[model samples]
Target chain A: MVKQKSLRTLVAAATAALLLPASANAETVKIGVVMTFSGGAANFGKQIGQGMELFMQEHPEAFGGHTVELIKRDAKHPGGDVAKAAVRELITREKVDMLAGFVFSPNAIASAELVTQGKVPMVVMNAGTAWITKLSPYIARVSFTMWQSGHPMGTYAKETLGCETAAVGYTDYPPGKDSLNAFQTGFEAAGGKVVDAIPMGGPREVPDFTPFFQRVKDAAPDCLYVFVPSGNHAGAVTKTFADLGMRDAGIQLIGPGDITQDTELQGMGDDAVGLVTMHHYSADYDTPQNQAFVSAWKAAYGADSTPDFMAVAGWDGMAAIAHVVKTLDGEIDADAAMEALAGWTFESPRGPIMIDPETRDIVHDEHVHEVVKDGDRLKIKVIDSIAQVKDPCKALKIGKCGE
Target chain B: MADATRARERATAHVVTAHRWRWVEAAPWLVATGAFFLLPDYMTLGTQIVITVMFALSLDLILGFAGIITLGHAAYFGVGAYACGMLSAHLGWTEPVSALFAATLVAAFVGWLSGLVLMRYHGLTLLMLTLSVAILLQQLANTYSDFTGGFDGLTGIYFDPVFGVFEYDLWSHTHYWYALAWLAVVFVVARRIVYSPFGRSLVGIRENALRMHAVGAPVFRRQVAVYTVSAGIAGLSGALFAQANTFVTLDVLGFTRSGIIMIILILGGTGRLYGAFVGAIVYMVLEDELSKLTPEFWEFGVGLALVLVVLFARNGILGLLDRARSLLAERGR
Candidate 1:
C-alpha cells in the first residue's frame, strides 16, 4: 500500500511537470520580431531592437503574469517578396501574440497584411509609409508617418525660416513619394513654391553624387530639401553636396526626419551644422521620461550609440503592447487589445500620444529642429512644435485611412 | 546450338541498347514535371516553386547545357521587374501584355549589353563582371529613385486580368496557377532546346570548349545566344513575380536576391529542371517552419541543413532518392 501511494505521487508530479507552460522554465512572453538585421537598414532595426530590449530589461515581468521574450529575424536588404514571406512565417507559424519591428516601409507593409490576415494586433515602430494606418485595422503605428514630419518641416520652412523657393530631392519609393507629396501640400498651403523635385531611388552606395548635386544646384532654390535614409547613403550624399560647394550656392540643406536621426551626417562636420529637420523625440528633449529613456538606453547600448527616432518609437510601442497585455492578463486577444488601444493615450518619452479612434492614427506633435554642436557631439535643438496634425491618408483618400 | 546462342546474344544487345536509351531519355524529365506541378497546395509555396523552376530553366541553358557561369543573373530579373512595374504604373497596360513586353525587350536589351562585357571574359572574370553589373544596376535603381521608386518600391499597383481571364488578387491563388502554366510552357521549351542541334553544340562546349571551338562551333555566339535566352526567361519570372504580388521593390536587384536564386538552384540540383522546382519548394517550406520555431535562429538550422546536404549527399535530395531506389533494386536482386 505504501509503495503504490509513492508511485502514484511520482506519476502525478511528472504529469504536472509535463503540463507546465514553457514560460515556467524561462517565463517570458515570446515576441517574434522581423527586422533588417543584416542589411543597409540594419542600423535602424538594431536601434529599435536595442530600445525594446532596454524596456524589457527595465520592466521585466511587467506584463500581467509573464516575462517577455523577443525573437529577432534579420530581413536582409532588398528582401522583396522574401520579406513578405518571412512575415507570414513569423505570424502564422510562430503564433506570436503580437508583431513588431520593421524599419523599412515595404517590410512593414507586407508584415501589416499578414498581421491583419492572422487577426493579430501589431504596433509598428518605424517605417512610416502612411499605408500602415491607411490599409489595415490590425496595425497601430507608434512612429510618425513621412507626411507627419514632412508637412511640419514645410510649415517651418515657410513660417519660421521665411524660405520662398525650395528644391526637393528624395528617394522615389512609397515613403519618399509620400514625404515629398506631403511637403508639397504643406509648403504650397503656406504660400511657398517648390522649384524642382528630384526623386532618387534609395540604398545608394556610390562614390559620386556630382550629377545629382549639379541638378539641385541648377534649380537655384533658396533651400534644398533632401530625404535620404540609411547612414552610408547619407554620408555619400552629404560628402558630395559638401564637395560641390553647394552651401555657397545659397541652398541651405533641409531634410525630413531621417536627416537628424542618421549618425553618418555627423561626419559631414560643419556642413551639417545649419541643417534643419522635422521629427519627433530629439535627444535634446528635456523631460524626465525622455531623460530616463536616454540614460537607460545609453547605459545599456553605450554612450556612443545615440538613439534614433525609430528607437524611441520602438520603446513606446513595447510599452503600449505591455499596457494592453497587462490589462488583458497577458492574453492578447486581437479585438480586446485593439479596443484597448483605440483612443488609448499614453505618456511616452515623446510627450503624449493620443490614438485617434476615428482615423486609427496616432495624432501627435511634430517638432522642427536644427542641428547644433553640443561640445563634440551633434544634437538637435527643437525650435518649434507642430501640434495635432491630421492623418494624411484621411486627407488624401488613399487606402482605408478613414476607417 | 551455336545459332541459338547468337540469337540470344542479339536479343541481349537489343535489350541493353533500349535500357541505355531509357536511362538517357525523356521519361525521368516527364515524371519530374508532373510531380512538380502536382505538389504544393499553398499559393505562396506553389508560386515560389514555379518562379524558381523558371529561373533554373533559364540558368540551365547557360550553365548546365552551355559553358557559362553567371553570378549576376538578378540584373536582368531586376530590369524586367522595374520595366514591367514602370509600364503598368504609368501606361496602365494589362498585366500579361506588360509582363511579356518587359520580359522580352528589357531583359533582352540588358542581356545583350551585359553580354558584350560578359563575352569578353571567361570563368572568374566573367563571374566578377556579372556581379559588378548587378551591383551597378541596383545602385542606379536606388540613386535614380524618380523612376524606380527607391527602397520603398512602387506599391499599390493593380494588374488587369490575364488575357481577360484569371484576375490577379492579393491572396495570390490565381497568380499561382498562372505562374504554374507559364512554368510548364517554359519547361517544354527548355526540353525542346535541350534536344536541338544548338543544345548539342552547347553540351559539346560544356564538355570541352576548346575542342568545340576547334570544330568551328562559333563558341562565343552560342554562349551569347544562350545567355540572352536565359536572361529573357529570368526576366519573365521577375515580371510574373511583380505582377503576381502587385508590388516591386528595389531589392530585386540586390546581390542577396541573386545569391538566393543560386542557392535554390544548388539545393534543387543544378542542370535539372525539376531540381529548381523541388529545391524552391523545400527551401521555402523549411524557412516557413523554422521561422516559426525561432525567428532569429532559424537561419542556423537552414545553414546546418545545407552543410549536411553538401557533405553527405552530392546530388541533393533527388539524387539521394535515386540512389535509394537503385539500392532497393540491388537488394531485390
Candidate 2:
C-alpha cells in the first residue's frame, strides 16, 4: 500500500510538471512571419520587421497577459521555389499559432493556402491581391487590396484633376491587372475614358518605352496613368518620360502610392514634380499617431529614413495584432483572437483603421496626393481623401466581409 | 599459343559485349517510382513531382544524350509559360490544345534562335551564352509591361476543359494526372531517341568529337537540333505549369530556376534518361521535408547533403544503389 501510494504521487507530480509548462506556454503565442528580407524585396521586409519590432517594444505584452513570439523566415525577393519552401517550413516545422506577412501575392497565396490548411489565422501585411480576402476566411489584411487605391485614384483623376481621357500602363501581373481593372471601372463610372491600357513585365525588363510613350502622346490623353512598382524601374521610366518631354506636352503623370514613395522618383528631381498618386498614408499624414510612428521610425532607422508605404503597413499589422492580444488578456486561442480582431479599431499612422467584420480586411481611407517639394525634400501632399472604403470582396459575396 | 588465343578472345568479347539489361537493374527504380507517384498522390506531392519529371526529361535530351550544356533552360520554359498565359487570356483557347501548340512552337523558336549562339560555343562559353539569353529574356519580360504584365502578373486566367471532357480545376490532383501523361510521352520519345543511331552518334561525339568530325558527323547541327527539341519539351513542362497554377510570373525565366533543374539532374545521376525523373522527385521531397523542419536554415542542410553526395557518392543515388546491389550479388555468389 505504501509503495503504490508513493508511485501514484510520483505520477501525479510528473503530470503536473508537464501540464503546467504546457499551459504556461499556451499563453505564449508563436507567430510565423514570412517576408522577402533578402534580395530585391529586402527593403520592404526590413521596414515590416522594424514596424513589428517597434510595436512590440511599445506594447511589450501582446494582449490578455499573453507573451508574443515571432518566428521569422526570409521569403527571398525575386521569390520562387525558395519562398514556397519557406512557407511549408513555417507551418509544418515551427507550428506557429498564427502566420502573416507575405509582401507579394504569389508568396501570399502560397503561404495563405498552407496556413489555412493548417487552420491557422493569417494576416497579410503588404500584399494587395483581392484573392486573399475573397478566397479564404483564415486571412485578414491590414493593407489595401491592389484595386483599393485604383478606385480612388480614378475618381480623383476625373473629379479633382478634371481629366477626360486617361491612358493606363502597368506590369502584366495579377496586381497590375487588378489595379488597372479597378481604375478603369472607377474611371469609367466617373465619366472618364481609359484611352489605352498597356501591360509590361515587372521591373526586371528595362523596356524601351519610346514606342509606348509615343503612342500615348499621339493619343493625346489628358492624363497618363503608370503603375511600375520597383524603385529602379519606376526611376528609369520617370526619367525616360521626362526626357521625352511628355510632361511639357501637356500629359499629366498619375499612379498609385508606389510612384510617390519610390526612392527613384525622389532621385528623378524635377521629373517627379506635379505627378499625382493615390495612397493610404504619406510621411506627412499630420496625425499624432503618424507623428509618433514617424518619430520612432526616424529614431530607430536614422534621419534619412525615406519611409515607404510598406512601413505604414508593417506598423499597422503589428499594432492590430498587439491590440487584439491585449484585449484578449493574453489568451492565444485562434478563434477568440480572430473574434477580438474583428471588432478591433486602432489609430494607425494612416488614420483610423478597423477590421471589417465581414471581409476581415481593414477598412480605411485612400488618399489622392500630388508630389510637391516641401522645403528641399519632395513629399506627397494629400489633395483629397476617399474615406471609409469597404472591402471589395464584400460585393463579390465571396466572404463574410463588412459583417 | 592456346593461352594467347584465349586472352585475345577475351579482349575481343569485352570490346563487343553490350551492357546487360536485367529486371533487377530496374527493380529499385520501379519501387522508387511507385512509391513517389502513388504514395504522393495521397499527400498532393505528386503534382510537383510530375512537373519536375517533365522538366528533367526536357533537359535529358540536351544534357544526357547530346553533349550540349545549357544554363538557360528556364528561358524556354518561361517563354512557353508566357505564351500559354497570353493565348489563354487573349484568345480564350482550350487548355490542352493551347498548351500543346503554344509550349512547343514558342519554345522551339526560342531554342532555335538561341541555338545559333549556343552552337557556336562549347564548354563554359555555351553555359555563359545560355545564361545571357535567360537574363535578357527576363529583362525583356519585365521592361515590356504592355505585354508581359509586369510584377503584378497576368491574373484571373480561366482554362477551359481538355476536349470538353476533363475540366481544368484548381485542385492540383487533375494537374498531377495531366502532367504525368505528358511526362510519360516525353519519356518514351526521349528513350527512342537515345537508343537510336542519332543517339549513338551523339554519344560518339561526346566521347571523341575530333574522331566523330573526322568520320563526317555534322556535330554542330545535331547539337542545335537536340537543343531545340529539348527546349520544346521544357516549354511543354512550363505550359503545363502555367495551366496547372492558372498563373505565370517572371520567376519562371530566372537563372535560379535553371540552376535548380540542373541540380536535380546532377543529384539523380545525369547521362541516364530515368535519372532526371528520379533526381527531381528526390530533390523536391527532400526540400519539402527539410523546409518543414527548419524554414530559415534548411538550405544549410541541403548544401551539406550536396557536399556529402559529391564527396562520397560521385555517381549519385543511382550509383550508390548499383554499388549496393553489386555488393549483395557478390555475397550471393
Candidate 3:
C-alpha cells in the first residue's frame, strides 16, 4: 500500500512541477487574497476582486513599475478552517509577499496567528471586528470596523434622530457583539436609554427576524437599531420590519449601512425608504471621486451589479498595498510595509481615509444616509457626515480592544 | 489427526505474520521522515495530513472492521476539540499532553453513553440518529456562545512546547513530528486490535451478526467496545488539531467534515489498516492542488476524482493496486 502510494505521490509532484509558474521577476509583488469566493457569499469575493482590478487599472503607476500578481483563494464559508489552510499554503508554498481580502471576521481572526508567525503584512479589506488588528502586529485594516459606524450611529440615534429610548438587535457573533456594545455605549453616553438588546442569531445564515422583531415591538422603544451582516440578512431584517409595521407604529428603523447596502438597495424596494444608517461609503455618493468610481464600476461589472462598501474597502486596500510597494521600491519587508501603511492617508472614493497608527485600524468619514426613493429606484441620500471617525472600541479602550 | 495438525500450523503462521513488522510497513514511516527534512515548506500541510490520517484510522476501526456506519463521528472530534480548547483557553491548562488525554477521556465517555443507544439501531435510522446527535451538539455549542465562542470561534488557545523542549515553530517542523509520533503509537495499537481474536470477532459480526449471536459472541457488547475505542482515537485526533491550530470553531462538528472523512475512508478502501494513510494523503493533496487550480469551483475537480474512484476502483485505490499487482504476477508466471 505504501509503495504504490509513494509512486502516485511522485507522479503528482511531477505534474505540479510541470504546472508551476516560471521564476518570478525581480519587481514582482505577489499578494495572496483569501476570501469567500464560492458558496452563498461569493459576491463578496467578486466585488472585492473587481475593486482591486479597477484600482490597478486606474493607477497603473501605483506599484512604481512593479508587476502585481494576485493569487486568489476561496475561503468558501464563514467557518475559518478552509481560510486557515489557504493562508498556510499561500505563506509556505507560494511565499506571497502580502495578504489581503477576508470577507468574514472569523476567517480574519483565524489567519491572525499564521500572519504573525509568517511575518506577512496583511491588509484586511472587509472584516469588521474591532479587535482583529490587536491580534497581530503585522496587520492593518483598510476596511471600517463595527465600532466606527455603530458608535456614531448610537449618538446620532439619540441627538439627531431624537430617540430617547432605543432597542438593538444584532446577529450573535464577535462583530455583532462589538456592534451592540458600541451602539449601547454611545447611546447611553448621549443620554438615551437602551430598552432591549437581543442577539438575533448566528451569522452563518439569513435568520428570521420575525420573533426578534416581535420582541422589540413589545418593548415599543422610540427607535430600533439592528446589526446583521451585509448580504441576505439585511434584506430579511428590512422585510421583517416592514411586515411587522414597526415604522407605522412611529418607531424609527436605524442601523449601520449593512441594512442599506447599495447592491441590495434596489431589491429592497421602497420598503427600505426612510431607513437611516451610518456607514463609511455609498455608491450613490455625489462626490466627484465617488461618481467616477461608480461609473467605472458600472462600466466594468455592469450597471445592475452596484459596488458596496466591501468593494470600496478592496479598492482602498489595494491602494495601501500599492503605496507600500512604491514606498519600499518593490523590496517588500513585513516590518517596512507595515510602517509605510501606518498613518497613511488618501482621498478615497469614500472621501478622505487614513490608517490610524495607534490601532492599525481605518479612520474614515462616517456618513449618516437615509434610504430615499429616487424615481423607481431606492437611493442613499447623505444627511450627515462625521469626518475621520476612529474605531471607538480602540479609542475608548473598551473590553479586549484595549489590549 | 494429520489434517488438524496442518490447520494448527497454518493458524500459528498467520499469528506470527500478523505480529511481525514487515519491511513494507516501514516504507510510509521512512517517507514521512524524508518529508520532514526535504519538504520543509510543506510541513504545515504534512501535519494536517498526519492529523487527518489519525482521524481516518479511528473511523476505520468501527466502520471498516466493526461495520458501524456513523455519520456523526465528528461529534467525538468536536467534543475533543472543545475540551482541549477550553482547557487551554479558559482554565490555563497549556500542557499539550495532559490536555489531550483529558479531552480524549471526555470524548470516550460521551461515545460510551451514545453507543448504548446506537447499538439498538441499524441502516438509515442509525445514520439519522448519529447525524441528529452531531446537529444537537452543534446547536448547543452555538446557543451557548459565551462558553464555546459560538460561530465566531474559540480563540486565545495557546499550548506549551511539546515535552518542554520542541516549540511549534513557524515552519511547523515540530508539529509534524509531534503529530507523527502520536499517529505511530495509535497505528500500532489499532493494528494490534484489528488483528487480535476480538478483532476477528468484529469482522465476524460485520459479516453476519445473527451467526455471531448464535455462536454466543455477545455482539452488542463487542460493537459498543470498538465504538468507544474508535471515538477515543477520533477525540485524540481532534485534540491534536485544536492544539496545532490553537483555535477551535463550529466546523469541527460540521456535517461537511463528517461526510469528507467518510468519503476518504471509502476512497482508500475499508477493512484495510493502512487505507487511512493512503486515503487522507490523496484526498487532502487533491483538495489542495485542485483548489489552487480553480479556486471558485474546486469541488468540481474533487467530485470528478471521487466519481472515477467509485466507477473504476469500487473497493478503492488499495483494492485497485492489489488487483494490478496480482495481474502482473500472473503475467510473470
lDDT of each: 0.72, 0.73, 0.88
True contacts kept of 3: 0.44
Model 3 spans with C-alpha error above 4 angstroms: A1-26, B1-21, B325-333
Ranking 1 against 2 by lDDT, winner: 2
TM-score of 3: 0.91
Please give, as one word, the docking class of candidate 3.
Answer: acceptable
Q: Kindly give the stretch of ten consecutive residues in candidate 1 chain A with the minimal lDDT sum.
A: A5-14
lDDT (10s digit) by residue, model 1, range A316-396: 887877777667766678888888888887777877887778656777778777878888867678888877776665666
DockQ of each: 0.24, 0.17, 0.31
The lowest-lDDT stretch of 10 consecutive residues in candidate 3 chain A is A5-14
Restricted to chain B, the TM-score per model reads 0.85, 0.88, 0.96
Q: Which lDDT tens digits does candidate 1 get at residues B1-333?
A: 999999999997874553233454465346445654664234565576677778767876787778688788888888888778778776777567656666668898889778866986888988998999998998788777666767767655567788888775444567777887787787777876776778878889889989998988898888888888888888888888777656677788877778877777777777655677667777877875564444445677788888988887788777777889999999999
lDDT of 2 by residue, A82-178 (tens): 4554555556556677777878876675555455566777888988866567546677889778667887788788988999999998876666777
Interface RMSD of 3: 6.7
Candidate 2 docking quality: incorrect, acceptable, medium or high: incorrect
